[model samples]
Target: MATFIALVSALLVSSVYSAKALSSNYYDHTCPQAESMVSRTVKKAMLSDKTVPAALLRMHFHDCFIRVTPFCLAFLLGCDASVLLNSTSKNQAEKDGPPNISLHAFYVIDIAKEEIEASCPGVVSCADILAFAARDAVSLSGGPTWDVPKGRLDGRISKANDTLQLPFPTFNISQLQQSFAQRGLSLDDLVALSEFAASLQSVCPMHNKVKNAGANMDTTPVAFDNGYFELLLQGKSLFSSDQALLTNPKTKALVSKYACSQEEFEKAFVKAMIRMSSITGGEEIRRHCRVVR
Candidate 1:
C-alpha cells in the first residue's frame, strides 16, 4: 500500500510540473509583449499618417457577414481576381471586382494584426489583435478609446459558411434586428454594433450603383463620427439599411437619440462592441481567437 501511494504521488507531481511548463510556454507565446512590439510599429505608420497598407484592408474580405448563431465561415471576399479571370466577358468582370461583399472593415483589423504577428512570432492571439485593431480603426475614424482585453485564445477552423451571416448593405433595419436576434443578440445590440460605423471609411460601391448609396454607413466617409445619425435626422441616409432607422417608429426613437448627440451613440457602441468581440470563434473569429492555454 505504501508503494502504491508513493507511485501515485510521483505521477501527480510530474503531471503538475508538465502542466506548468506548457502553460509558461503558451503564456509567453501568446503574450502582449510580442504583440505590443508589432502594435508600436503599426502606430508609427499611423502617427506619421502614412498611406495605409492594402493588406490591412484585405484582411476582412474573407469573413464579413458571419453570424454568432449557426456558425459558418464561407469565403466572401478576396476572390475578385479569380472571379474576373474566369469571367466570360471583360465588361462582366469589371462590373464586379470579385466580391463576397465588402470585407473592407475586417481587412483593416486583420492587417494591424498581421503587423503584430510579424513582430511577435506566435505570441499574441489574433482575436485579441483584432479587438485592438478594431479599437484603433474606430479611433482612426474618430471613435472613442476602448481598452482591448487580451489573452483570448485563437481558433483553428476557417469555415466560409459563417460568412453568410453578416448583415448586407441592402438589409433593412428589421432584417438586421432579426439577424442579430438569430445570434441571440438583441435589437439594442444591433444599434450598438452599428456604432462601429464611426470608424469606417466609405464602403466599397456595391456592384449595382443604385444600391451603393448610404451603404457607406459613416458620415466622415473617412473618420468615425455620429454623422450617420445626423444623416438619419435629415432623412438623407444613403441605404434602406440605414434609412430604416428613421422609417421604423420602434427603431426611429434610437435614431433621434443618435442624431441628437454623438455621446449617445458612443455610449451604446462601446458596450455593444465589447459584446460583439466577446462572441469570438464561431467561424469568422475562430481561426484567430479560440486559442486555449
Candidate 2:
C-alpha cells in the first residue's frame, strides 16, 4: 500500500507540474459574467430543489471520469461537457447511459447556458458552465469556493457506452485506486473526492419498492461539509466503495482527518476538484449544450 501511494504521488506531481491549458480568467474579456450566471442559476434551482447541489456536483464528476481511455491509461477530453449531450434518434448519449440514468438537474445547466448565451453569445462553453455550476453548488451549500479555470470545449461525441467506464459503487480498494490512477488522480484525490460518493447511493435501499422514497447523503444532505466523512467513519455509508475507504490504513487516516476538520476537508476538496476538472477534451463549443454545433 505504501509503495502504491508513492507511485501515485510521483505521477500526481508530474501531472501537476505539466503546462496548464486552462485559466481562471479565460473568460474575463470574452464573458466576464459567465461564472456569475452559472452561480445564479444554481442558486435559483437550489431554492426550489435542495438536491440540485449534489446533482450538479455528481454530474461534473461523471463528466470527468468517463473520459478516461483504458488502453491509453490517460484522460482523453475528460470534463468536456459531453455528459450534457442529449440522445438523438440515431444514438444514445452519456446522459442516457445506464450509470447516468439517475443524473438530474441538467435543466439547471440548460437555463444557465441560455442566460449566458443571451448575455455573451457564443463566448462561453458548456463545459466551463458545468464547472462553474459545480463550484457554485458547493459554495452555496456551505462548502468552500475556488475560481474555476475555464477554456474547456464541449465534446461532440457522447456515447452511452462511455459511461460504462465509470467507477462503480461496488468497487474495492484496488479497483478504486486503478480507476483514479487511470485518470491521473492520486489516492489523496480519491479520498478528497469520495465525499461526493455519498450522493451516488440509491435513495432507497436495494429491493425496496417504495415509490418516491429516498435517503439523504448525510444528516445535512443539502449542505456540503465533512459530514460524509464523519458518517463514513460511523459505518453509515451506503456504498461498498465508501466503506472500502476504511479497508486501507492510509485512506482510513484521511477519512478520519477530514471528519475531524471541515477546514482541511474543504481545502483538499477544492484542490482536488480544480485538478480533476482541469482534464480537458473537446473540439468545438456548441451553441446548445445538448447538441453539437
Candidate 3:
C-alpha cells in the first residue's frame, strides 16, 4: 500500500511540473520584446479597422474551443497555425470548417508574426502570439487586459472534422454548460465567456434575413463592459443562447452578480482567459504562424 501511494504521489507532482512549462514570463529570456511587438501590431490593425477587436477576440475563442473541448492533445490543433492552414487535396484544415468561416483577424496575427520573426527569429510560438494579440485586441477596444502565459509550441496537424466540437450559435444554456465542461471549464467560466459572446454579437451581427440574430447584445456594443449581464437581466440579449443563461437558476445568479460589479467580471474574465490559453499543453515555438516548421 505504501509503495502504491508513493507512485501515485510522484505521478501527481510530475504532472504539475509539466504544466508549469508555460509561464507569464516565458519570453523574458528568449525574446524580451515579443509582447510589446505584438501589442504594437495589434493596435495598428485595430486603428485601421474598428472591427478588428471583435474579430481578434472571436479568433482566440475559436482557437481554444476547437482543440480544447473534444480531442485537444489527441489532434494537436490548439491555437496553432493548424486553424490557419489552407485546404489541400489531401488535407482539410480547420480554416475551411463551418464554425470558422466567420472568423476574422488572421491578417493581424500574420503581421505580428512577420514582425516577430524579423526581430526574434524562432524564439516564440504562434500560440503565444495568438494569446498576446487577443489580449492586446481587448485592451485596445476598451476591454480588461491580462497577462498571457507563453512557451506554447505550434501544432503540426489540422483537420476540418476536428473543429466539429465547437459550440454552435444556437446552443442553449444546458448545451453551453456541457460544451464548456468538456474543456474543463465550470458554470462560472461559461458566464464569463458569455460576456465575450455578447461583445462579438455587435461586430458580427447577422444579416436581416437571420431575424433577431442581428440585434446588438448590449447597450455598449463596442466596449468590453458588463453590459452583457445587464442585457441578460433585462432579457434583451441578441441570441437565444445568451438569453438561456437567465433561464438557469445558478447562471442567473452569476449574471446578476456580474451585472452589478464590473471588477468581479474582469477578474473572472482574466482567469478564464488564462485557463483557455493553457489548453494547448507543452508545444514547440514555431517560426511561422501558418505552416508548422
Name the best candidate (by TM-score).
2
lDDT of every predicted structure (CA atoms): 0.45, 0.80, 0.72
Task: For candidate 3, give the lDDT of residue 109.
Answer: 87
**Whole-model alpha-carbon lDDT for candidate 3:** 0.72
Q: Check candidate 2 and list the clashing pairs.
A: 77-281
By the TM-score metric, which is better: model 2 or model 3?
2
Candidate 2's clash total is 1
Candidate 2 residue lDDT tens string, 130-174: 999989877776678898888988888899998988999999988
RMSD for all candidates, in order, please. Answer: 13.9, 4.6, 6.7
Sort by lDDT, best first: what order? 2, 3, 1
* Model 3: per-residue Cα lDDT at residue 134: 81
Name the lDDT value of residue 152 in candidate 1. 45
Question: Which ranges of candidate 3 are over 4 A from the true structure?
Answer: 1-20, 69-73, 203-222
lDDT computed for candidate 1: 0.45
The predicted structure with the larger TM-score, 1 or 2, is 2
Runs of candidate 2 exceeding 4 Å displacement: 1-20, 73-75, 199-221
Instruction: Give stretches of model 1 more than 4 Å off.
Output: 1-30, 44-67, 70-101, 104-120, 203-223, 282-293
